[model samples]
Target: MAAEQQAPSILGFPHRPEWGAAAHRRAVAGYLRRCRDHARIGARQAARCIGTSESTLSRLETGLAPLKPVEVERLLDVYGVRDPAERQRITLLVAEATQPESWHPYAHAAPNSLRPLLAMEPAARRIISYEPQLVPGWLQTEEYAQIVIRATHPTLPAKEIDERVRLRRARIDMLRRRVDPPVLLAVMDSEVFRRQVGTPGVMYRQITYLLTLLEDLRYQLRLHIAPLSVGAAGAIGHPIVHLRFFAPEYLPDMVYLEQYEGAVYREKPSESERYLAVLNHLCGVATPADQTASLLRQALDTWR
Candidate 1:
């Protein structure tokens, strides 16, 4: 009897050429290491059960090579893990981790480790971004962005920081130049306008800059303020940049979650849905756009 065909190795996800398989390799290796530790099984013993040499298992665990899905199943079975839910979860994660990150090449300009959720920008239908602390890069004025870059990256030499700010400003041009640009939706917390990163003069200019951007018909700017009554709920956690695309293939909806030190692009259906829910809740709790603008205007008037 013929053996059943094994599932395909995740050669590339989203079918990009410069995909990075290493991230999945590392994640799978980490999982295997943890599993081995939990089961109190030595590499040689586990390797014997999985029909691989001890050194091969060591290499796989250390991410020197990719682990086959069948081998992964074998390891889990030998560990005597009986929980069906956990088994399915492990198998799914193993597949996902192996799926190549198609955005890895673009990550060169940014940090190499950033798991950015970027598809073909030219094909997206709508781009929704929310920032509670700083101006979204897409809407930032040149000077305001410079002040932010300088203040946050004090260690970088002034020239390098200037170049970085310039690159950031250039990215904004896409909103205007793209033939079919995504309808840009920006929702900022009122405190974003109030937070003074530079001189009073610089901040005044920044507020005016945002007011000017609001004049653009294509810019669907919906600024809001989280009230003090909401307490910490109003506080911005990590900035979330969600992108929705109009593709017939796997491309659909994605969320780009950013932290100061790292970022991850979440394409998993459940994760994407959860983020959308969080945004909806936050929007419901936040003050209306007009009120947010009024609060911003008031802050600008009081800034000096």
Candidate 2:
């Protein structure tokens, strides 16, 4: 009888099981780029050493393409990576990068532009969000989400809308249930409360939910209201989500900007830091967290 084939071992190198596939891919790409630079190898030289085109190497380094195990080994060899433990760890990263993300099932309902953000949210250590028009998706109640979805995508069928709502709910539940949930600091313009999404009832329920989350000690959430009273403040005037990961992951901070048709992602430190600055300004100018509940109550009164 033929002997059973065994999978190759990772030599006991630990991989971050909590990170999603997107995070792993970015880490692998960043590590490969750093290794090549550290070895004083140009892109052309590295590509030639690996017997591939520079464009392919560029894609792999940018996280646009996955690196095969053989390719990883060859790159390590070329980069003079002699440390056995480092090799094992990178090999494990490549393996994990190829795995499916939890958001894969919602791919059909989610826009291609938004999938990357979905995959990265779970792996983030801190999420700083700013909303000028409406409540952020992570804090939206079901009724509020449904109304927002329908208004935003009037052409989408009810079934598709329901799927989107479910996706948002899943994200909220994941954060709530996570043992070490990311620290969420959300800043919302007071106009969000005055916008009146669905109905007075919906707005009331949603604000109540926000208050409940703010009061819950178990959640690492901080809410701030950018009061309309703070007129002409230095605000970004659009929605922004800045996600920061732990250092051990080797992942860079990412900024997500949503537009009407598509979204834009800023990964460069300079670009992301600009957005971070705007968010920081908003946070600084906004009502303090302790006073947020009062603003919420004022809105509740207005809705009432």
Best by lDDT: 2
Candidate 2 runs further than 4 Å off: 1-14, 48-51, 217-219
Residue runs of model 1 more than 4 Å from their true location after superposition: 1-109, 113-122
TM-score of each: 0.59, 0.89
Name the candidate that leads on TM-score: 2
lDDT, residue 49, model 2: 80
Q: Supply candidate 2's per-residue lDDT for 200.
A: 92
Candidate 1 least-lDDT 10 residues = 4-13
Worst 10 residues of 2 by lDDT: 1-10
Give lDDT tens digits, candidate 2, residues 1-304. 2322222223332476666787788787877887787777899989998788999999999888877888888988888888877887887888888888768878778888888889888877889999989999988899999999999899999999999998987886546745667888999988899898888999999999998888873367889888777677634667899998854347789899999888999988999899888888889999898888878887899878
* Tens digit per residue, CA lDDT, model 1, 14-64: 322222344345545656676677678898899998888999999888666
